[model samples]
Target: MKNNVKLARIKANLTQQQLADGVGITRQTISLIEKGKYNPSLKLCLQICYRVNAQLDEIFWISEEEFNSEENN
Candidate 1:
């Protein structure tokens, strides 16, 4: 899935490590999430949203095609 985690992080003036620290996750995990290499659990996702002061959809919303494909899995 695609996300705007990096964008929100930048808009919040947070480095990846800083955001990770705020959310209690590893910096690598935040990097992976931004790169779309990992999908965070809902709890973790909510943490990120809260840290970045972003609405869930603003950061973690996926494209319709991606969402549809996931439904097929």
Candidate 2:
């Protein structure tokens, strides 16, 4: 999945560690999520969105190409 987590974090003026602390996750996990290498659970996603002051869709949006690729896979 693709996400604008890093962008939102920057916009919110939060470092990875700060965001992780707010969401009760590790900095590595936040890094992984920002890189789209990790898929957070719904609860975690909600927590992150809240911390970043962004809606879920705004942070984690699926592009048409990604959706198609996932379907194919």
Candidate 3:
């Protein structure tokens, strides 16, 4: 999956460490999330959404491929 976490984080003037600390995760985890190498749980997602002041759809956008795959299931 892809996300705009990095962009939003940057726009929010938050470093990876800052966001991770606020969200109670590791900086590496935040980095991984930005890189799209890790999938955050719903709890973590909510934390990020609130901290960044961004909507779920804005940051963790659902790709067309993922949406179609979900429909298939």
Q: Best candidate per TM-score, number? A: 2
Instruction: Kindly list the per-residue Cα lDDT of model 1 for residues 9-63, writing each as its tens digit.
Output: 9999999999999989899999999988899999999999999899999888878
Candidate 1 C-alpha error for residue 7, in Å: 0.2
Better of 1 and 2 by lDDT: 2
Instruction: Write down the TM-score of every candidate.
Output: 0.87, 0.89, 0.85
Q: Which ranges in model 1 have alpha carbons more than 4 Å from their true place?
A: 68-73
Candidate 3 residues lying further than 4 Å off, grouped into runs, are 66-73
> How high is the CA lDDT of each candidate model?
0.91, 0.92, 0.89
lDDT of 2 by residue, 1-72 (tens): 678999999999999999999999899999999988889999999999999899999988888998789667
lDDT accuracy of residue 4 in candidate 3: 90
Tens digit of lDDT per residue, candidate 3, span 1-73?
A: 5789999999899999999999999999999999878899988998998999999889997879886785676
